[model samples]
Target: MNLYRKVVLSLVIALPLSSLVSAQDAVKQLADKLQVMDTLLANFQQTIKDSQGAVLQQASGVLKVKRPRRFYWRTETPYEHLVVTDGKILWLHDLDLEQVSKQPFSADMDKAPALLLSGEIAEISKQYQVQALTSQQFVLSPRTDDGVFKQLTLEFRGASISGMILRDSLDQTTIIEFSSVRMNQPLADEIFQFTPPKGVDVINNEP
Candidate 1:
């Protein structure tokens, strides 16, 4: 699967609802959570289901995130793909393909979900229009002519993000669930660096 498909397919689930929450309230709650977080470490269980409500795939991993665009997503699952991003570049390594892909941070800054990884919370409001709070989630739709991703739904447990549902322009939905999250943990910058192995195909998609 491609990167977008892999990411989109990883968030389906059939778990019970943990609580009753409001979307408007959740938006405020999400904003507060992001506002307060400088760094974070956590284990996540992502269960992706199809539109028919069938489980497609499941993956678990430990995520380490630092402020100003840095993340380490190490997967322990059916397949392995390592994604890392420094403030300057994004690296995606496919274990199965033994291939590495790199892109300039600025080239795909708007298209890539870099803001979601970094502490760039200030621009979210400017780029998207916040909708009314729902019973279990808050919704936001992009205000610009951005390609593909049409809307984003965020599900929360009190303050922390419990899940995220993304809808593309094609009406395909991708849901992401986050659990056991630890916030404000110290992280080393070296963890985000990428060095491709010998003989592996390297695709540089940066402009």
Candidate 2:
């Protein structure tokens, strides 16, 4: 999958939910917390597991997200891959493949989970049915069936997001743990701009 799809899919997955008034309240509180931060930067370790709970893949990376619509995600270990979006264009660079792909940011892309990180909290309620498992842990199930993810779980440490777990229709599970998280930090505008290096083939995926 492309970087955009990967991140978006990872952010939305399916999980079972239990109805409880306290859980719903916790979800609301978590939404309130997300609304206060305009930017998030963190180091993350992600692990993917099969339906049988066998490890499928593991990777570590740095993730930076800016409100409205901008982000820089780089996987540093296992391999080098970068994905950046400057609100108008999306760039994916595959260091091993020596290729870079570009596509115009479209409305469909706006529906991705990047929006959940940057868009208004009210929109979140409109898109997902949230159930809180604990004061700091919440599960979100997409309101629409068009999404590939079945459910997504988010865990927070105080006001900072500490981990995320996603389960897809195929029963594959992806767990991402965060550390060194810094919220509302000033990130340079240039970090979201990508200029493909010399000798790397540039593929225009925009139609």
Per-residue lDDT over 21-124 for candidate 1, one digit per residue giving the tens place of the 0 to 100 score: 54335445556657777787777666555556666667776677787777677676756777777878777777877878887765235334424646476666
lDDT of 2 by residue, 1-207 (tens): 644346433452144445567546766787887877789999989888889999977888899988767878788877788878878888888887798988886645544553466555666766777877777888888778764667778888998989888777788888889899999889888888889999999999879
Clashing pairs in 1: 12-47, 12-48, 12-49, 23-133, 23-134, 24-133, 39-184
Clashes of 2: 4
Angstrom error at residue 169, model 1: 3.0
- Give Cα-based local distance difference scores for all models: 0.63, 0.75
TM-score of each: 0.77, 0.85
Clashes of 1: 7
How far off is residue 28 in model 1, in Å? Answer: 5.7
In terms of TM-score, which candidate is strongest? 2
Q: How far is candidate 1 from the true structure (C-alpha RMSD, Å)?
A: 6.1
